[model samples]
Target: MRYKGTKAGAIVVAAVTGSVVLAGCGDGSGSQVEGGGASPSASRSADAQEQGTTEVRAAYEKTAEAESARMTIKMNLAAAGKRITSDGEGVLDLATGDSVMTITAQDKTIEQRVVDQVLYQKVPGQNAPSGKPWIKIDLEKVAGQQGLSNQQIGDPAQTAAYAKAITDKDVTKVGTENVGGVSTTHYKVSVDVSKLPGGEQMSQQLGPTLPMQVWLDDEGRLRRQQIDLTVKAPASASAKPEGSASAQQLKMSTVMQFSDFGTEVNAEAPPADQVADMTDKALQGSRQQS
Candidate 1:
């Protein structure tokens, strides 16, 4: 299939999130924030909140230090009265921001590799037009038009954005829990979308703040993370004729599980002869149509 205009950019962004954001699914079961006056009891609650924020920040920093790790991602997206789920597994190098992952959805598996901030995908039969096995997308070029940066397209880079969102007033400790058989402490925080990379575009659909949950192991390593996004369709979308199945709202839940920290990951770009530049092709197609 051919990717055109913003639609193509959105698809690429979604694929990039599979590796960058790295989240998991979780029920919104957490300690609720209590109202606080200037009383002594309120002071104690404030202290606890500060401590929780510190702990969560530490885990975020420590996890960013990991050299490499094996990761698996599951995303459930419901839109227009239809649901689609995608699963992916890969190894990510936190230091270099390189990754190799295979994602499967709707009975089709796509091989994706990120090298030096550029993304390469190999789709079965989709490359027949170019007689190539791989399609390449330059994140830098796309970022110029899409309001995304290559620095925010990798696992580690996006992880860094969390640092900007964590604040003592908004972080809450949700007690201890076990993830994947390992004991961990759960923390819930509201992420300010404006602080994220390319967040301005998303804020329109996802709102200003996004609720996120994270589980950290004893050593302050991130074991799991989750985010759920719900978006209401614009009025223009419902402009279809009567009895159409246009979606009123879209919901997307993502879960990312982390394992085997410090693992070795080797990813490289595909051979030039076997790779096609999708950006160039799209430009050429646009010129011809014009």
Candidate 2:
């Protein structure tokens, strides 16, 4: 999905930080821990005990497998000490042939639409060229092409990838926090950006390491996430003769909180022709401006 213009740049910056934070926090491996100063037989017994405990923990962490729900997320972003906050509400309907997430937000009386999984700021007095101004993603198509379901968050195969990316030693439990009245475990996880799918380019453009914190509910579903990020200003821009004094570092923080989640087993899908028409109108509007 693409968002154009100045607003797009700002939204992208915030969204990228939010995405990284979520991905980093939710990636961890479930591994057995060995006890110290135990005899060989005793060690075997200890291993078994530890294994059982791990299984119990894992069971508690399993999230519900429902395919749809209404969700509300509030995000607060701070960059160089300046802050911006926004709240979004959406319905995630996955039971339909295609998974659809429709989100809308208002900054006072002005309502903005989020389309195709991308956020867009509605211009005042200007109607959306298309009836719909939100970004849409076809989850069924994505899963069919990728051979995985959205419900595979707890699948062994999927967890293996998260496990490999996250070392057991890298997960540091930071006690517990209350989220929506639920006491959840908080963990700080560090990932080697070099190990991710687009780590190389990301490291070059963003950085080498990404640090995130996650709050996990009793059922192991991620309830909240936060990330510290740094995106460097392009050298050419920073070096401009008329530019402000150069700073070697730029720091930003982003957060996403998930709530009111459940399966929407009977939600209806938006018709294909409607999606096509809206998309075409939006595209034509963009081209006219260009």
The per-model lDDT (C-alpha) reads: 0.62, 0.42
Candidate 1 residue lDDT tens string, 87-140: 889998765667899878767787888787677887676673578888887665
Q: Which runs in model 1 stand beyond 4 Å of their true positions?
A: 1-41, 78-83, 124-128, 149-151, 155-162, 195-202, 230-251, 280-290
Query: How many clashing residue pairs appear in each of the predictions shown?
Result: 5, 11
Candidate 2: regions farther than 4 A off: 1-6, 9-61, 77-83, 93-125, 128-163, 233-252, 263-290
How many clashes does the backbone of model 1 have? 5
* Ten residues in sequence with the least summed lDDT for candidate 1: 24-33
Clashes of 2: 11
Error of 1 at 118 (Å): 1.7
